[model samples]
Each structure stands twice: as structure tokens, then as C-alpha cells.
Target: MKFMMTFHWVPDTEQRAEAIERFLRTGGVPPQGVQLLGRWTSADLGSGFDLLETDDAAKLTEFAYQWSDLMELEIMPVLEDAELAAVFGRVAKK
Candidate 1:
């Protein structure tokens, strides 16, 4: 199954950037086939996210935990469309 990864912090851009950079610096790579859609630090800094794509739930969760270990990510939620008639298409799954 595919998962949507999101993180909410207490609101700090400089720290957020630093953390993300630090993560990459430490060679933190997500699961295979995961695609980074985009990332944003809220104007209020209440939260932010690096939009990503990953079909491997296990690997994705593993990587996500690493981030939480390094940085205190507030919230992480996964979602999916239950409708069989989704307009776009089905999320390719194994």
C-alpha cells in the first residue's frame, strides 16, 4: 500500500531546514520508488512536509522513524482513496 507522509513541528523554519539538510547529510534515504513531491515550511512554522511517494510501507515507516529519532516530527498520517472509481487511477500496488 502507498502512504502519505507528513510531519508537524512546533514552528521553526531555520531549524526545519537545518534538520532536513542534516538528514540528507547523514545519508538518510527513503524507500525505493519513493518520490519527493515537494516540501514546505508553513509561514507560521506550525508544521511542514517533504511530499513523497512510496509504495513500500515498511521501508517508508522505517525511514520516517529515523527522522522522528533525529527530529521531533509531531504528526505522521497515511491515507488512501477507498473508492474503486477514483477519477485519476488506482495506486499501483503489489
Candidate 2:
């Protein structure tokens, strides 16, 4: 499954800096079983979004735990456009 992880950094500058430094030090590696497909950050640096693929949701939590201290995270399951259309079609038929 694919998931969209939204990260909203705390308003504190020091905490945000610490989070960035930690990530840099660790090479910004994603948790096991989680493949980071892409990422985009807000121009203001207040928040960012990551597209990740993983079969095990547990692995997603591992990634979240690493940065939870400095940022608020929201993980949402997502599907491609065709997949969503197919789902809607199935539901409509029922």
C-alpha cells in the first residue's frame, strides 16, 4: 500500500533545527519496509509531505517515531487514481 506522510514541524526553531540535524546525521533513512517514493516541502519550511510505499504499517510507525519529537505527523493510506475509480465503481454497483 502507499501512504502519504505529512509532517508539520513545531514552531520552535531550535527543535526544528535539532530534527534536521538528526536526520542529516542518520542519512535521512526511512524505516525498514518503507520505501520513500518522493517528498515535497513547503517553501516556508513549516511542513512537508512524503509519499511512501509499504506493506507493513508497523514500519511506518518506526519512521514516525524517529521524528515525532520535533514534528507532528499524520499518516494516511492512499491509492492511485485508477485504483480509486475502480473502488468507486465496485461500490456503486452494490
Winning candidate number (TM-score): 2
Query: Model 2: per-residue lDDT, tens digit, 1-94?
Result: 9999999987898998898899789966797799999989899989999999999988889998888888999999999999999999989766
Clashing pairs in 2: none
User: TM-scores across all candidates?
Assistant: 0.52, 0.92
What is the per-residue lDDT of model 1 for residues 1-94, given as tens digits with 9 covering 90 to 100? Answer: 3344566664566767877687669755565666666566677655566666666667666777867744555434445555444634666453
Give me candidate 2's TM-score against the actual structure: 0.92
Count of backbone clashes, every candidate in sequence: 1, 0
lDDT of 2 at 72: 94
Give the backbone clash total of model 1: 1
